[model samples]
Target: MNPEDLQKLVTMTMPYGKHQGRLLADLPGNYLNWFAREGFPNGELGKLLALMHEIDHNGLSDLLKPLRGRGR
Candidate 1:
């Protein structure tokens, strides 16, 4: 995915729940894993989270480090 899309995923706030206002990318791995087990939510946000999960799972979070550093 493009950096802008990834940035939006990383910085977007959760609309609800205990982790509300937290960045999607910053959500704990266990939490995301739980979602994977239980199934992700519906719509674009869910898609983004699933994508983030894959990225994080592959240990390529560093690929986004530059974008994060750029403050996008």
Candidate 2:
């Protein structure tokens, strides 16, 4: 979607839940799917989760590779 959103995937940590502390980009597909089915959280976290879900769902996760270590 936007550059900031994509960057947040790599740089931001999940603020809560089983995946807390994990990079949003690295969240498991199944986990993302659960959010897809159950509805993602509200606001920016939800948006990013939804975006990551799409990326993971469509197998476009590789696109995130180039941006991954950039945040580290």
Candidate 3:
């Protein structure tokens, strides 16, 4: 995905949960891993987080670093 897409994925608020309103990028890796093992939810957000989990696991979070600085 492009940087803008990555930024949106990171900054988007969680629609439901105790951590609702928190950014997707800020969610703990363990939680993401749990979703990975259990199966991700349906919808675009779910797909995005699943992709984020893979990217983060692969040490490519830096790919979004530029967007982070752009304040998106």
Tens-place lDDT per residue, model 1, 1-72, is 666778876568777878888888787788888889999999988888898889888887777666654454
C-alpha TM-scores of all predictions: 0.81, 0.94, 0.78
Better of 2 and 3 by lDDT: 2
Candidate 3 lDDT over 1-72, as tens digits, reads 665668776678778876788777776688778889999899878887798898778877777656653554
Report backbone clashes per prediction. 0, 0, 0
Local error of candidate 1 at 17, Å?
A: 1.2
Number of the predicted model whose lDDT against the real structure is largest: 2
- Candidate 2 per-residue C-alpha lDDT over 1-72 given as tens digits, one digit per residue, 9 for 90 to 100: 899899999999999999899999999999999999999999999999999999999999998888877856
CA lDDT for candidate 1: 0.78
Which pairs of residues collide in candidate 3? none
Model 3 misplacement above 4 A: 2-4, 69-72
Ranking by TM-score: 2, 1, 3
Consecutive 10-residue window with the lowest summed lDDT within model 3? 63-72
RMSD of each: 1.9, 1.0, 2.0
Residue 61 of model 3 has an lDDT of 75
Worst lDDT window (10 residues) for model 1? 63-72
lDDT value, candidate 2, whole model: 0.93
